[model samples]
Target: MRILLTGAGGQLGRTLIDRLPTEWDIHPFTSGELNITHYPSVKHRFLNLRPDVVINAAAYTAVDKAESEPEHAIAVNAEGPALLAEAANQTGARLIHVSTDYVFDGNKSTPWVEGDTPSPINVYGLSKFAGEVRLINTLPDALIVRSSWVFSEYGQNFVRTMLDIGLQRRQLSVIEDQIGNPTYAGDLADFLIFLAQKPQVKGVLHFAGNETISWFGFAQAIFQAATAICPAYASMQLTPISSEQWPSPAKRPRNSVLCSLRLAELGFPSSDWRARLSEVVPQLLAANVLKKAN
Candidate 1:
């Protein structure tokens, strides 16, 4: 299959570039190379390439910053996917777009299912939800995967941030009230590739790590994993605090755990997040060590 991937410079995009099936021919584009916000550029590129599948991994992910720059966020997150769907429709290509769990209000006690109505509380979430609506309206067959708390070896994410901060500061504060599943970008990339080959999968789907934890709990796990590789992280202190204690420009959902019932039914099993973290933390610490030496 010929697959065209957007956001190749991002965490998920980077992972997908490395993990995509070797048999498939990939035309990867970073935002700098092909800005999704510019429909003429995206459409022209797609028409020429004529890919069998188009995976949109690009997004405006600054949750708090979106409050101040809603227009920019909408242009990238909402308008971009819609334009991609239009191009894919003209080219008769399947589209797999990545969304977020933030679409929900985060008030539910149980994990969110695909059928749940979205009630986004923040500009970032609202923009993502809008993107989903736009894509579905343009192409009903488009596959939309909604995930949460993504982290990996590449890109700016919570895991890397905590590791860097924990090494530099002896003490830190993390919000304990917010809870959600943390996804491994590598695993998500693998699944997206699996879906690309399977034409049967359509509509909204949920995929996330097996376990759900708060930011504070995730920090503890990160430190535990890092300390084994680098002793300096062992002395770091992580203080658990409430969301109100650390106010942000945008309001976040208190609970945004996604239930991957549909994903499990499709035969893709969920992996333990802590186990995945252990595998990644060591690599991250090793990279840090090498960076300091140079």
Candidate 2:
């Protein structure tokens, strides 16, 4: 099968490219290579390649910066997906789009199901939600996978930031109110590939790490895991703060844990986030140590 993977430079994109089944013919493109916001560029490639599957991992992900750049955000996050959906429709390719938990307002105490009403609190979330609407309108059969708190060794994320901060500062403060699952990109990638084979799967589905925890709790776990590799991370004093104390231009949801009911029904194995974290934290810590030595 011919698969065209966008956002090749990103954490999830890289993971998908690296871990996708070897038999599939994968054509991976970074944002620099395939500008999804530009229709002509996106069109030419889709027409030429005519891939059996188009996995759009590309996105404009700067949450705070998006507040000031609404047009740019919409262009990439909203309009880009529309373009891909249209192209995929024309090309007869199945499009799997990656989205975020931010689509819903953090008002609900329970994990968000696919049917929940989306009330995006910030420009970034609104843009992603808009992208979902556009994709569904364009292709009702399109598979939209919504996930949250994604982290991996490949890119800038909470896990890497916490590990770096712990090494530098004697004290660290993390927001405790914002709650969600901390999904490993590698695991999500694996799930995506699994879904690709299941032609029956369509519409929006939520896939995240099994456990839900606040940012503060996640930080505590990061420190706990990394301490085993580098003792320097242990010296940092961790403090929990409310979202109000750590205000940003982009307002975040207080709680956006996603329910994996659909995922479980499909026979996807539930993953223990802590166990997955254990596997990657050592690699991340070791990289930090090597960087320090360099």
Candidate 3:
């Protein structure tokens, strides 16, 4: 089957390129290759490729900046998927659009279920939610996977950021209020491949990492894991701070955690995020983000 992939440059998109089966035909489109926000470009590309499926990994993920640039966020995140869906509908292709936990308000005491009603608290969340709304209207069968805290060897993410600051500064402070699952890009790719093959698995799904923790708590794990990987991390000092203490334009989810019971039942078993982190940290470090001999 022919597969058309957008946002071929993100952390998840990079991993998806590697994990997708070599047998299938893949036509990758970068930002320069395809501007999804523009309908003419998206329609032209889709008509040219006439792919069997379109996996849209492209998104404007600037959370803090979204508060100020809500229009750009909506155009890229919300409107982009709608345009992709239009192409997919015309080409009679399946659509796999990636979404985020930011769609939720993060007030739930428990992890969010697939059926939970979304109430995004910030511009980013609202934009993503708008995308979802348009997708369902455009194509009822489109697969939408709602994930959280996605990190990988490539791209700018929390894991790489923490590793950088953890090594560069003796003292680093992280927000203690936020909580969510940390999913590896490769892990997410594996599950996506399964859904791609099994077209029946359409609609909203969650593929969050196996474990759940607060931002500060997750930092402690990162440093602890770093120490395990590179013993030198024992010398690092990491501090915890409240979100109010470090003000940002956007209001992040205090309880961004999501429940994956539905995902497990659907055959996508959970992965040990800590164990996965240990495995990938080396690559991230070697990728030069850490920049020290491990």
lDDT string, candidate 3, 1-294, tens digits: 889999998888899999899999998888898999999999999898899888899999999999998999999999999999988999999999999999999888988988999999999999999999999999999999888998888899888898888667777888887889988888888887788888887889888888888888878888887887778777877678898998889888888887765675677777568888887778766676435443
lDDT by residue (116-174, candidate 1, tens digit) is 99999999999999999999999999999998999999999999999889767899999
**Candidate 2 regions off by >4 Å?**
none
Ten contiguous residues minimizing lDDT sum, candidate 2: 263-272
Which window of ten consecutive residues has the lowest lDDT sum in model 3? 285-294
lDDT of candidates 1 onward, in order = 0.92, 0.91, 0.87
TM-score ranking, high to low:
1, 2, 3
TM-score of every model versus the real structure: 0.98, 0.98, 0.95
- Pairs of residues clashing in candidate 1: none
lDDT score for candidate 3 against the true structure: 0.87
91 Cα displacement, candidate 3 (Å): 0.8
Clashes (backbone N, CA, C under 3 Å), per candidate, total 0, 0, 1
lDDT of 3 at 119: 96
When 1 and 3 are scored with lDDT, the better candidate is: 1
